[model samples]
Structure formats: structure tokens, C-alpha cells
Target: MRYEKIKTLSELKNIIKGLRAKNKRIVFTNGCFELLHAGHASYLQKARAMGDILVVGLNSDSSVRKIKGGPRPVTKEKDRAKVLSLLWCVDFITIFSSTTPFNLLKAVRPDVLVKGGDWKVKDIVGSDLVTSYGGKVKSLPYLKGYSTTGLIKKINLLTPRRCAVRTYAAGKKGNTL
Candidate 1:
């Protein structure tokens, strides 16, 4: 079945409500997903297995910048959303600007909220909200050493190192060298 992509909060809410009325199980997961890696694919597959529908919340460009600092999310938001929207395990993708998935959680009210094993259940975003709504929160085992940050660090290490020259300008404004 061809799934539709939801761009606005209102549309997403409507879709979720409609799905719920049809008794469709909804699962949600959120992340930056700068570079879609093996771990991401597997995690998503697992998440989809736990429910009838899977919705991915992608952090907006500004949100990525705010949390990951500049030079982050090498992929633009449009590209990221497009890529995620095409994933086999993902039924829908939504872009959000919040630092956390709190607002989106309140709106979608997914039947299942999923995260990587790295987070304690209590600390995971949307955990409380899902539980409060009588929905379940789950964690998928993280495929270690398969994250975007780790990939970036590996790239940096593989590149040639530059020496920091310690030449003293020695208060050169006053010519104290």
C-alpha cells in the first residue's frame, strides 16, 4: 500500500486519529539520522515489526544545528526527509523543530514509542507521555559503532593530522617577540 507523507502537525494528527479509528497500531521513533547507517535500517525494521505502522520524526535543520552544533547533519532537511520517506520500514516521516520530540509526542500519541537501548526507559523522550496514554515504550538494541557521530570521528581519524604550530607572535602588537 502506498503511504502518504505528512508535513504539518495538523495533518499528522488527523492521520494518526484516522489510523487509530481503524485499529491500526502506530509506532514512533525520532532522530537526526544525518547519515542513514546499517544500524538505523535494522532498528527501523525492528520497530516496524512491533506495530502495524511506523512514523519517523526527523529533526529539522535548525533543530539539528541547535543540538549537534554547526557542521552537523551534513544532509539538508529536504534530502533527509526525502530519504527517510522512501524507507521500506517507515510508513511516514515528519519534520519537527523542537529540541526534543515532546510536542510531536503529545500530538501523535503513538501506540508505541521506540528508542535505542542507550537510553534508560525513563529518560527516553515521549516515554512518559506514551505511558500516560497507556501506550508502550520500547528500546531496540543499538548496533554498536554504527552511529553518525562515530562515522564522522572515524573519517576525521582516517584523514591526515595537522600539527598545531606554537609560534609566538609574542605580543606582536607591541613587537615583544
Candidate 2:
């Protein structure tokens, strides 16, 4: 069911065209979304409330690696897209291999472009293109203390190094930890 929400760029463009014919407002946002969190859900919901449809442009695995460096994006792009597709607020998703969503924005031409509060409207990539076409650009409120990096760090702190090694050795020995 969630898989249906993921679309190719051409498919998404056609879908957007149809929606626009019916006067539906399209909201757009892009991110790596390496790990889903409460903050991501809240921001997406808020962005959806601003328009009739919400299209999320997910960064491909290579793109994430380029932007965030090695060993980032703990989850692969397909997995990330699948998780986001499960969210009710996300109408459709398109995976892009670019560092920025500027080209994707040019294709979607969303009615509203949004990003987390951490990004100023002027700093959001494609903000100029969106605004030039009379589309609105918004910076939604970012939830504090909720981030993938923080979650990863917390998880690392909770997993003792010795415990991890023991768990691995036990699994290899056909034993349960």
C-alpha cells in the first residue's frame, strides 16, 4: 500500500499536472530523512496542512553520501522512502540523485515549498525558483531534541561495547544473548 506512494519523476510530473488541472495546491519538501522521527512527522503534517497535496523529494543514497559524507544515511534511500510513504501526510515521494532539489522543484513547480525551521526561507534551495513563479516558501517549526544524529548517538551510548561483541560472538556460536 505504501509502495504506491513512491513515484518516478515522470509519473510525479504527470500526477502533478492532473492535480493542477483540478486546482489542487501542491506542497513540496526535500530531505535525506535517513531516519524517521517525531520532528519529521510533525513538520510534514504541518506542510501538508498548507496545501492539498504534499510531495516529498527524497535524496538518493549516493546524494546523501555526497552531502552528508561517508557512513551517513544509516538507512538506504529505498528504505527511507518506504518509511516516509507510510506517513499519512505524505501524498507522494520521488527519489532524486542530486545534492539539491532545484531541478526537481523546476519540474514539480509546487504551490508551496517548505523546509524545517533550521533553514531560513532564503536559504532553502529552490526558494528563488518557487518564489519567482509566485509560489510561497515556508520554514516550518522544527521540534527540539529530535534528530537522527542524536538518536544514533543515544543508541551508541546505550549499547555497551562489550555487550555488542558478546552478542555478535554468541550469534556466531548459535546461542542467544
Candidate 3:
């Protein structure tokens, strides 16, 4: 079934409610998704396989900054959501400004809550709520050697540094020596 991507919380809630009423198996996962990578795609696909509908809670730019620190989320929240929407496995996308997806997860109340293996089952937010209702929580294995932080670090290393320009300037200071 074709799912409309929703940005607002109210719209998402309404859609989720309707889907639930029809007894659709909802699968939920949340992340900053600062950079689109193969790992992300694979993880999302695996999570989607767990249920009929896959709802992705994308962290807003502000939330990314808070969780990932400054100079992070190379892509804005809207752009991140756009990238996620392009994936066939992604059924719905919602940009949440909260640092944690707890509130969003609680509202969705999915039948299955999934996260990457990096996260311990005990650490997954909203696990309690889902499990209390006989829902399942899963932590899928992460793809090795693929991460936003690692990607950023690699890019930084490959790019020429400003210190190289600074070294040239330092040699000409006051025309001494």
C-alpha cells in the first residue's frame, strides 16, 4: 500500500490511528540519520520487514545538534526526511524535535520497535510501552564499518586542512628570518 509521508505530529497520529484500527502491524524506528549510508538503508529495510508498516521517526536538526553535537547533521532535517522517503522500505517519515524519540514512539505505539544493534534492547526508548502491550522489541545487527561519524571523519581526513594555509602565512610574519 502507498503511504503518504507526514511531517506534522497530528497528521501522523491520525494516520497511525486509522492504520491501527485496521490492524496493520506497525514497525517503528528512530534516528538522527545525519547522513544517508548503506548501513542505514539496510537497517531500515530489516526493520520494515518486521511489520506491515514502517514508521521512521527522524530527529529534527535541533535534536541532531543536541544529541550529535555542533557541526553535525550535515543535512537538514527536511533534507534527511527527503532522503529517507526515497527508500522503498520507508513507509512514513516524521521529523521530531525531541532529543529522544520517546514521545513519538509512545504516540505511535507500534507493534514492533526496532533499533540498530548499536543500541541495547534495554536502551531503546518506548520499549516498555510496546512490550507492555505484548509488542516486540528488536535490535538488528549493525552493518560493520559504516556510520555517520566514521564517514565524517574520513571526509575530514581526505580534505585539505586550513593549517596548510596557516603554515605558509606563518613563514612571512613581520618579514623576519
The numbered model that scores best in TM-score is 2
The 10 consecutive residues of candidate 3 with the worst lDDT sum are 159-168
| Runs of candidate 1 exceeding 4 Å displacement | 1-6, 158-177
Give residue 83's error in model 3 in angstroms.
0.5
lDDT of 1 by residue, 1-177 (tens): 333574677888888888999999999999999998999999999999999999889999999999999798799988888878788889889999999999999988889999998888889997988999799999888988798888888777752335334444754442221
RMSD of each: 9.0, 2.7, 6.7
- Count: clashes, candidate 2: 0
**Model 2, residue 172: displacement in angstroms?**
10
The C-alpha stretches of model 3 lying farther than 4 A from their native spots are 1-4, 161-177
Q: Candidate 2's residue-wise lDDT over 22-56, tens digit each?
A: 99999999999988999999999999999999999
Model 3 deviation from native, Cα RMSD in Å: 6.7
- What is candidate 3's CA lDDT for residue 50? 94
- TM-score, per-candidate, Cα-based: 0.84, 0.90, 0.86
Q: Tell me the deviation in Å of residue 128 in model 1.
A: 1.3
lDDT of 3 by residue, 1-177 (tens): 333575577898899899988989999999988889999999999999998999999999998888889788899887888888889999899999989888898888899999999889988888888899899999999999899999898878864543244333556643322
Each prediction's Cα lDDT score? 0.86, 0.93, 0.87
How good is model 3 by TM-score? 0.86
